[model samples]
Target: VRTVKPELVFEIGFEGINKSSRHKSGIALRFPRILRWRHDKKKEEADTLENLKLLLDPSNLSPDK
Candidate 1:
């Protein structure tokens, strides 16, 4: 196995996001896949962990808006 530094950032698509104790981020993504390679973006420009956590909000998951 080759170990590579965290340099590349990609946009990921997922069916759902949920809180999970099994993950370090305390969040889990269902059916995740690489939507696109963000070549134009730098690693520093990646989405923040807080932003991802926002998806866990109950209001955001509500079927009725």
Candidate 2:
């Protein structure tokens, strides 16, 4: 049998990492969920690991605190 993959992609911004798991390369998103879908973009055009790391960088966090 053939499996169908999801075509939708989303952009999410969260507070911070709440947990880190030992599963799956020991990397996981914190409180991640569907923020939106980029129907106009192909899967290859989606955000990558580097992008996620950049967003999660400590220097990039808000200065409110």
Candidate 3:
């Protein structure tokens, strides 16, 4: 994750050319400053690989993508 750090994650979009054909992809994220930390939650309860993929599904992301 350090290799991608703060920049590389932005390469992806909820929708668009950036949403490529890879089986698994990483996307850029913003608004983390205003977001809540999951410190109260355990790693098992936090976002997982499957959760990220679920967020990318066409039915999940807003049309603004």
Candidate 4:
């Protein structure tokens, strides 16, 4: 098993993203899994918030459960 740090990048698979009052980013991941470490890439090359938002299903953006 590989452990990821804040400065490292992980290929994660999650069910969805949700609004979160507790997180600084105001978004949370549902049933997230750390699939693997992106060893060939640098941390700076990791996905950004915009990248994540772009991948989100627009209709599912609402926080309502």
TM-scores for all candidates: the values are 0.76, 0.49, 0.37, 0.67
Ranking by TM-score: 1, 4, 2, 3
- The Cα RMSD of model 3 versus the native structure comes to 8.3
Q: What would the per-residue lDDT of candidate 3 be over residues 1-65, giving only the tens digit for each residue?
A: 23333311221223322223332345433322323444466544544545555555564354334
Instruction: Tell how far residue 13 is off in model 3, in angstroms.
Output: 14
- Runs in model 4 deviating more than 4 A are 1-6, 57-65
Per TM-score, the best of the predicted structures is: 1
lDDT of each: 0.79, 0.55, 0.39, 0.75
Looking at model 2, residue 47 earns an lDDT score of 71
Clashes of each: 0, 0, 3, 0
User: What local lDDT does model 4 show for residue 46?
Assistant: 90
Q: What is the lDDT of candidate 1?
A: 0.79
lDDT tens per residue, model 1, 1-65: 24557799999999988777666766778899999999999999999879998878585453322
Error of 4 at 33 (Å): 1.0
Residue 3, candidate 4: C-alpha displacement in angstroms: 15
- Stretches off by above 4 angstroms in model 1 are 1-4, 59-65
Displacement of residue 19 (Cα, Å) in model 3 is 3.3
Question: Cα deviation in Å at residue 63, candidate 4?
Answer: 5.0
